[model samples]
Target: MNDISMRVRPGTATALIGRNGSGKSTLLSILAGLVRLSSGVLTTGRPGLTTGYAPEAFPALKLTAEDYLRGMGRIAGLCEAAGRSRVSELLATFGLDSFRSRKLAGFSKGMLQKVNLIQSLLIRPQLLLLDEPMSGLDLPAQHTLLDLLQELKREGTALVFSVHEPQIIEAMADDLYVLQEGQMLRTIHGAENLRSAPAVYIVYTELHPVAQQAVKAVPGVRTMQPAPDLSGISCTGLTVDQKMSDTCLQQILAAGGSIVSVKPLGGLGDLTEWMDPKDQIGSGRG
Candidate 1:
């Protein structure tokens, strides 16, 4: 974790991406105050800031899911009534209401993971840290959790989670920090724009109407629209199938359009290459 500097803004989701043993868990622990930083400053927007942390694994306890959550809520300083209400609400929200009285020892991996997430979300902390949040779940359950997290983010909770799945990163993360051997390798902003498309490239340039039409006429161009504030035109195209990027570039250049920047949107392949070469692209865990 040396020379690491990053910010998790309110209402934004930040993702920690890395291979196994890359200190993702350690960094989350530090942020959650479960582990202390050996050096460097950690500043929060306010004192006594509430933070929730959900680790990758949940212990199998003999207690019922509801009872366990109630105990945790009490430990978090919620009153008995509040604890009961929140526990019930979260259990039902995660589609575990019917199994609230079931012992955690008998629960399946996906059910336990739901309990793990519910516990961290009990107090509705300003900042929530989750490690491998989507480790064990079906597609529907995953979508349910994502929707809940998005609702929390809308209410101004800062989310920081370690993840490997490219779909999760595209669906939730506003910014992504890639870690390798405990070092910050890259910080990618606007991570939400990443799509599952084969390959999408964003081109920034100032172009007249004629040039815009010319660029749009390129075989692979998907869209050509004016940039926000009308500074220039932004062109998006698909590039992987026939390697049409070169042709697109040539078209823009031939139209006398000055290129500002051209970059490909991060996709499954890009994320896999960024995290680790040996691992599969959508394994859903780090």
Candidate 2:
């Protein structure tokens, strides 16, 4: 990374956007203190500021999920009892309580990702850095994690994450940073400017099978899919026309469906096109 300067304030979310090998992950690592900066100065709001980092690829270990979390808590300076309690709480919150005793080596990609997040959250750090926090999660899991992060933001924790998902940037980002070849290409302060056109809105909902059919019958719902267990519908990419979005949402709510998130279709498009000179809106120095 070079000539990159940014600030993360309490209770705000910062998003890093870039193509592969553009140094997004490297920037996050530098913020997490995992990588040393060869030049430039780094400062924080307070000295010894606590920070947490969740990586994209989680390791598959022989240890059980519970053991792994507890070990992480201990490493974060929690006492034995506190570590055990925190482990149990996080496992239950992530709906992995039953799988606590299961070996991490046997866990699926989604499950391991949950463990990865749980470990980083062990200390309740003041600053959190996530390298693709939603990498391997399903819609429901992603919703749960988003809700948790929203709550953390409300509680005054600073969040900085690198992501390619437009939905995530729409839902969580307060500031957007576009990087190119280890340089700070542009910075957009508010995420609202990310939307190019309001043509389609992607709606996420959890509903019973009967409600699922009702939603499918909605006039403008273009696509949908069912949840893994068939307990509810998990729309892979439920694209609804902009004009019908409000009415469609109302009908889903009327049918007792829980709306997780509704985001515009093409808010952030292909990363390469972000450098277009004509697309400048909220671009500025950090």
Candidate 3:
């Protein structure tokens, strides 16, 4: 049930995207040499050709984030003097200076994400492969990472990474590969689909058990779901006949429940349909 073949040329930014368990991470690991390919050849230009890799799994043992990055720098073959300077510079750039001495065990998910990114960027490599590098970052942090990628691209570093968010793909990726069932289904020629808003929204609220009850009273709620971890609840397959989301938002706020986030159900336009849509024309989806 798995198959993929890609020619990753130098100086190109490629994105790998797919639903959960579709093998994005597995493909990345294969490329990183952390895992051996089952039946294919992966050849690189040189034995010493630098390649920076950041995988999701981290060491469980006690160690500061700084310690890990410093070690990576040394292992990548930078001399002691350069490794020391590079590690310090990367830690500060990724906003982990305050946590320099803090053990990785206590780092928040977001902090761990920053450290993951920092390690990959600490020393300039000929190729950079990131696996969901922006998973836990705030908006500002995401922007910072995008800027860093742009810098790398300008310097002729070939970059490939995986991301689920359309916004991330729209803003950062130069090309996209959509994968499913471990097979490469499509290589999108343009990035237009990423900029369009989802045709439908599923709103979730904070009141939980009560919120579920009230939403049922609302005529537009077509489906109800218990939130992950039972944090609250959500509604989906909204009744199309009414203006439900705005009304639902008001009702939830009045009931002392806050809107957690809106979920996008795809009706976003096709990536090929728009040579240019006015609303998305200048925002730079491509």
- Per-residue CA lDDT of model 2 for 175-262, tens digit only, reads 9898877898888786576644443554555667787777678786776754343245554346665667787788778977666667
Tell me the deviation in Å of residue 156 in model 1.
Answer: 0.6
Across 208-257, the per-residue lDDT of candidate 1 in tens digits comes to 67766676777766666555432434543323322576777777678776
Q: Under the 3 Å rule for N, CA and C atoms, how many clashes does model 1 have?
A: 0
Shift in Å, residue 32, candidate 2: 0.9
RMSD of each: 6.8, 15.1, 15.0
The local distance difference test score of model 2 is 0.80
Better of 1 and 3 by lDDT: 1
The candidate 1 region of ten consecutive residues with least summed lDDT is 233-242
Give the winner by TM-score: 1 or 2. Answer: 1
Superposition error at 229 for model 2 (Å): 62
Better-scoring candidate (TM-score), 2 or 3:
2
Model 3: per-residue Cα lDDT over 142-199, one tens digit each? 8888888888888888888887665667776667776665678767544454443443
All candidates: TM-score: 0.76, 0.70, 0.66
Candidate 1 TM-score, C-alpha based: 0.76
Stretches of model 2 off by over 4 angstroms after superposition: 195-286
Candidate 3 — which residues are off by over 4 angstroms?
Answer: 190-286
